[model samples]
Structure formats: structure tokens, C-alpha cells
Target: MGNRTIIPFGPQHPVLPEPIHLDLVLDDETVVEAIPSIGYIHRGLEKLVEKKDYLQYTYVAERICGICSFMHGMGYCMSVESIMGVEIPERAAFLRTMWAELSRLQSHFLWMGLLADAFGFESLFMHAWRVRERILDIFEQTTGGRVIFSVCDIGGVRKDANAQALDKILSVMDTLEAETKELTQVFLNDSSVKHRTCGLGMLSGQDAIALGAVGPMARASGVDLDMRKLGYAAYGKLSFEPVVETAGDCYARTAVRIREIFQSIDLIRQCVRLMPEGDVIVKVKGNPDGEYFTRLEQPRGEVIYYSKANGTKFLDRVRVRTPTFANIPALLETLKGCTLADVPVLILTIDPCISCTER
Candidate 1:
């Protein structure tokens, strides 16, 4: 073996959007092992359940992660609703599904931009984010808040999209679909992108399963796992398949996310077409007496929310298992045998959200 060196990659780095520290053990320029150290931005949001009432904690849950904020609030609310046996209105369920899919689109777009930036394709990065702004504009028009939408409540959504809003969403989807196809073509077909990503940071399907990879990371490796298939929210009514690629490399992972962007657009359209007419929320009475676990597919991957209540206003505990946390082990596995120069791209492939993981 060549002389070994240790390189630390990010609690803060130019490439990473969130704080995640990894100690990269290297023999010359190739990484031999990657040891992760989390908890840099641990805000102890889960413990806030003790102080915040179950209803009020929905906002707190939304604060867990900005990109997947809607799903975080929705997941927390779903847990409380399940525990209380509060069946939300059908219209509310469809609305939640629409927002969830929109969240996925924005997240995947942001990731594509970051990946483009990592490739040093400045124009491509700007083009990707410019498309993402349209999605955010839709969020602002519908939910009133672009990021931390307080629309999702304990029993159901706090707000409803009117006919005009729904029509606008459909129109926006039509435009975005065309725009995204053109944008993603560069990532999918560009020789430079393929040269940088193809066969790099490979993780076999078996290794991905063993390491507990989730979301695009697992799907890219042909693991065929998607929490949405469990029929949560309006997913049961929606017709779609999880995007998968068997190569289990950086290219495959990128491909999965790229396809998922279009999938999310289709899902939103379905939600609009099948939207029910009724009140958005049901009155949720009384405190939750038992614990319940809710799983939802966040943009990054599967997020599990566990809520325990003691028949009080405040919850006994709120625990969240974020996808980034689950995929860390798999990320370390991929880092091995990769050159130091490829580390940033490899890390971005997992789409790490340390804010979500460390929350």
C-alpha cells in the first residue's frame, strides 16, 4: 500500500449544503475508509415535544428541515392523527399528497443544481435552480409560505387550494414538465457528466441492502424500496412506479432523482384531477393517549415519525428517523475505493441533509 493520509471532509465544505463531518482515510489519493461524525447541528427538536403541545408541535416539526418541511409536519400530524383516530377529510388527503409531490420536485431540482455546480457547469446549475423557482412560486401562491408551510395541521391541512389555485398548479406542471426535460437532458446525455459520474463510487445492490440505504440511494441500486408504495397519503390512488437503475453508481443515483422529478409532476396532476370537495380539516379533539408511528416518503427518502402521548397536551416523546441517517452507512461504503477528488460528487449523490439527520 502507498503511504496513508487522513483527510477530513466537511463539518463545513464548499460542496456540502449542510454540516456533515467525515474522516476520510486514504492511501495516496484513493479513499480507504470514511468515518462519519454527526450531531453538528442537532437542535434537539424532537425533545421539544415535552414543551410544545401536540398540536403546536406541528410547526416545530416543520422546522426540522427546510427542504422537506411540509412532509415533516405532515408526518408528525399523521402520527398524532393515527393515535387519536382522527380521519382527515378526503380532500385534505389529496391536498397533502399534492404538496408532498411538489416538495419532491423542488428538492430534486435543488439537488440537480448542486450536482451541476459540483460539475463546474455554472450555467446548468443556474438553469436548474431557475426552474426550481417556479415550483417555489406555486408553493407561495397556494400555501402562503414558500418553505415552512404551516398548512399541514394535526387533523388535516390548515388551508385548501381553490379551483383557481388547482388550475394554476396544473398549468405550471405543464410548463415545468417541458422545461425539466430539456434541463435534465444535459445531466443524462452530456459526455462530461457521464465521464465524471458513470461507474464512479459504485455500491452494489446487496451492499446497499446490507447498509440500509433508503430513497434514491437504494432505488438506484435496484433495492425497489419506496415508502410511498405503502399507500400512505394519496399514493394508493396514484399510479406510478419507483424509478430504479441497477448500476448502483453515481450516474444511476442521479438518474433516479432525475426521473423522480417528472414522477412528482405527474402525481401532482393526479391529485388535482381527483381532488375531492369538502372541508380541508376535521376537528381533532382530546390529547393522544397512545404512541403511533407514521412513515412517509420525503424527497430524500423514507422518514419515520414516532409520537408518544400520555393523554396530555404535551407529547411524551417525538422521535424522527430521517433517511440521511439511514443512508450514512451506505455512503461510507461507497466512499471506499473512490479517489479523493470524487468525494464531493459521491456525497452529493446521497443528497445528504444533515439538518434533517441531526435534527
Candidate 2:
């Protein structure tokens, strides 16, 4: 251990946008181990299922994590729908997929900005956020919320975008794609950025799989596991593949997300093209009497939602397994042997969302 000293990194830190405490054991400036501590912002949102009616809990689900609210709500709704034997309208499925891709696009953009900010590239950070605002504008125009969109419901979505609106969304995505290309090139090709990230905090493919990593973290490590491939929602109708990088380092993680942004844009365009004219929501009836487990591919990773009902309006139990929670073990592993200065960027690579983790 070489006379290890302990340092607490978080609960409040400039580089960390969310609150998470890591007890780092350091030997001269190299981190030997990192013990993560969360729960600083647990709101007990899952427990709200006991108090709120099943139909009303979708809103609470959306509040679990602002960055991933739409997916959270969708997961809960999917679980309840599974239990209730409700088949959502075809049009609603396509719309949900479109919105999900939009959410992914916005999330990756936010992560890119945060990563840039962490590396002290202020101009890159600003440019990333500027592009992200266009995605948010599309959300507001269609779903009426920038972050916690209350559009997803049990049987289907509450709002519907007409053909013209869908066309507009596609146009907006094209514009965003054109504007982001130069920024993406700079991130991937710039020598300074490469020097800062290329080999730092490496996790091999086998290690990532053994550590139960998911989403881009696992994908970056060459573990080809995407819950979307399971054909939930309208993803079965779309043609896309998960973005994977074999390097499994900070740079590879960045590359995975950058590629995923373009993938999401392509997915949104496909969903809009395949959208059919029909009702967005079907009538949802009956109490959820059994249990169902639903999985969703959030921007961070795979999120599992479990819902149990005792033949009542209010659900008996709701449990969520967030991506960050699963990634913590991988986070701890990546921290080992890395220099103290690189800790924040390593943490950002997993795209930790403490609100989602602790919820």
C-alpha cells in the first residue's frame, strides 16, 4: 500500500456536476482504490408508487433523473403496461421511439459539453451546449418540456406530433447534425484532446464485462450489449447498431458517445419516416395485479424497472436499477492506478447521474 493516504472527492466538487463522494486511497498522487458513496440526493421517488395511483406514477418516474426522465417514465409505463396487458397504439410506439432517440441525442450532447468543461476546454464546452439547445428546442416544441417531459403515459404518449411536425423534427435534426460535425471532428482529431484522454483510465473488454458495465461504458470496452437490440418499442422496426470502440479508455468512451449522437439522429430520422397516422394513446383500463420487469437503454446504460401491484390502483412496490449504480464497480476499477488529476474525467466517462443512481 506504500503509506496510502485517504482523500474525499465529492459531495461537492467543481469538476463533478452531480453530488457523489468517492473515498480515494492515494499513494503519492496515484489512486490505489476508490470507494464510492452516493445517497446525497435520494428523493424516494420509487416509493411514491405506494401513494400515487398507477396512472399517476409516471410523472414521479420522470422525476427520477432530469437528464433521463423520459426513459425512466417510459420504463415504468412499459412495466405497468406489461402487467395490465395493454397494447399501446402503433403510432404511439413510433412516436415513443422518436422521442427516445431525441432524448439520447440531447444527453450525449450534454455529456460532451461536460467532458469538455472537465478538460478546461471552455470553448468546446460552449459549442457543445449550443448545439444541445437545438435538441432541447425541438423537445419543447413537441413535448413541452426541456428536461422532464411529461409526455409518456401508461398506454401511450399524451401528445402526438403530426406529419408536418415530424417533418420539422427531421429538418431540425439535419441542421443539428451539420453544425455538430466540425465540433465532433475537433474532439476526435485534436492532438491536445487526444493527449489528455487517449490512454487514461483504461478498462479492458473482459474487465468491463466482468464488472457488469452497460451502455457506452460497456460499448467502449467492446462489450456489445444494448437493451434496444431486444426489440422493445418501435426499435424492432428501425435499423441501427450500437456504437462500439475496442480501446476501453477515456478516449474510447468519448468516441462511443460521439458516434452514438449521430446514431440517435439517424434513428430519429428513421422513426419520423416510418411514423404512421393513428391515435397516440389507447384507453388504459384495470389495475395492475401482478409484477413485471421492464428494461430500457438509457443514455448512461441499461435501466431496469420492476413494478409489483396487488390488484389495486396504487402499486405495491417499484424498484429501479439505474445504469450508474451498475457502473460504480467499473468506476472503482478505473480509478485504481490513475493519477489524482484524472479522476474527474474518468468519472465523467461513465456519465454518472447521481440523481438516477440514488433514486
Candidate 3:
């Protein structure tokens, strides 16, 4: 204990895509305590809601973070729709679900690549991102941008996936899933991954819930609260449950995400089979004059959007509660008594995108 020293891990970590600083107290490669720091990229996006019209704010919402861009847009739209008390067309809801699952698929792939990179698996990292890149290419063709696809509108989606393009997308996803399945063996069977992540950063179900952990973190810890089960958007028509793992270690989290990729593929396939035809979006004519809350299962965890409208183009107030922000307390708790070698891997498993929170 006398030899322990505290070190700053980030705000500009090489392995992390977003800026967040961790104060790690270490003694001979063992972590004694962990402290989290945020607010580096705070853009005050929520405050912008008061200035931008609900229709145009979709683009602003997408900027909350690149990985879960679709979820952010969808969440905002869902909340505002609740205020307006208007139901979107069934076809539009289904379209939102298809794209949301697609967002999750690519997000998990991107996280896998980042996880691989953290463990020094350069080839595996590239391999994972290769699959992610394929998805991004599809996103680009469909929504005109790969990272920040402003595809959601207040009533529904900004654009529709036509039959031919939708079919092509499904075919591409099928091939990607097959390739990803083969790679899963590499993560599960590799001794290096097991040694580094198997027993690292264990989070118990009680602690996860108490700390308000969301998404894969809570699911990995054995809590099964998936917002999709609430039947928002097209998810009500879909049949599935949240994936859970009892171990609550980095290995469990990795397994959960790998399984979710398969699930995403299944979800997209279902959307294609059950998709009906209708207008992609309906014009929202009036201003919001009520308070509403919306939640979604982003690839990282649960995301929340809240809005208060004053019957104007501008909202009275808007608040975004991101998963990474909520998971900070749990992360700090897990780092205690862990080896320094385990620090980066534990953080990677959470896929912390500080931009999602700080903004």
C-alpha cells in the first residue's frame, strides 16, 4: 500500500475513441483505486433543443455520439411524439426498429475492434473493424453518412429502405454474421483473452442495479432490463428477451455482445420479413407543450432522453442521460483491488464513449 501511486489514464487515452480521464492508483501493477473524470467534450447539446426546431434537432441529437447515433435520434423522436400524442405508422415504427438493430450491430462490432486493440490483438482488431466497415458502407449508401446518420424524424424516419436496397442490405448482413461467427471462436478459445478478461472487473447484479448500470453492463451482471421489451417503435411486434450473463466479468460482457450481434442479425431478418409499406415520415405541425421521457437500449447501455416543450419551435428544456455517465460509479468501484494490467481491458468492455455523456 505504501508503494501505491496514482496515475492519470486519460482525457486523451490512445485506446479510447472519446475523451475521459481515469485516476488509477496503482502499486506494483495492481490497482488500488479508480477515479473517473468527464466533461471534456461537453457541447451542451441538450440546451440546444430550446433553439432548434424539433424537425431539425434530429441532426443535433445524432451528434450525441457516433456509435449509438440512431438510438439517440430515435429516443428524442419517441419522447417528442409522446408529447404530441400521435402514433407513427406501423411501417415507420418497424423501420425504426430495423435501423436501431443495425445501429447496435455495428456498434458492437466497433466495440469488439476497440476491445481487441486494447489487448494488443492488432490483427483481430483489424478483422473486427473490417466487418464494422462493411456495415458503415451500407449506412452510407442508405442514409448518406456512415457515422452520423440523421435518418430519424419526429414522426418517423427521414428516409425509407426500398425493397431492392433492403434486400441487398439483408444479404450483406447474412454474410457478415457468418464471418463474425467464425471470429467468435478466436475470442472464446484464445488463452490470452481468457487470462486477461475472464476474472477481471467482476460486477454483481445487486451492485449493477444499485449503481443504475444500463445496457450490456447490467445485462452482463445478470440484470435483464431491456427497453426493447417495453415495445417501443417496432420492437413491440418483435419477440425477444434481454441477454444476461451471471459471471459479470469482462469475459461475460464480451460474450454478451457477441451474442447480441447474432440477435441483431435475427432482428433485422425479422424486420425484413414483416416490414409493411407506408409513408416514411409524417409532418409534425405543432410545437411540443408537455413533458416526456424516452429510453432505449444502446449498444453500451440504457440511454434516456427528456424533453419539456412550451408550445414553441424551441423546447422549454431538454436533458440527455447517457449510459457511460451512469456506469462511471460502477466502473470506479470495479477498479478497486484489480491489477493495472486489467484496467484497460475492464474499461474497454464498457465501451466508454465519453462524448455520449459529456455532451
- Across 52-164, the per-residue lDDT of candidate 1 in tens digits comes to 88888999999999999999999999999999999999999999999999999999999999988887888999999999999999999999998889999988899989999
RMSD of 1: 0.9
Per-candidate TM-scores read: 0.98, 0.98, 0.97
TM-score, predicted candidate 2 vs. hidden true structure: 0.98
Question: On a 0 to 100 scale, what is the lDDT of residue 66 in model 1?
Answer: 94
Descending-lDDT candidate ranking:
1, 2, 3
Q: What is the lDDT of candidate 3?
A: 0.86
Total backbone collisions for each predicted model = 0, 0, 1
* C-alpha lDDT values of all predictions: 0.92, 0.91, 0.86
Q: Output the better candidate (1/3) by TM-score.
A: 1
Q: 1-359, model 2: which lDDT tens digit per residue?
A: 47789999989999887889989999999999898877899888877777899988999989999998899999999999999999999999998998898999989999999999888899999999999999999889898889988999999999998767787898898899898898899889999998889998889999998999999999999999999999999999999998999999999999999999889989998898888888999998778899999998999999999999999899999999999999989989999999998888898989989998888
Look at candidate 1 and tell me the lDDT of residue 148. Answer: 83
lDDT of 3 by residue, 134-199 (tens): 888878877898888888888888788888888888899889988998888888779987887898
- TM-score, cand. 3 vs. native: 0.97
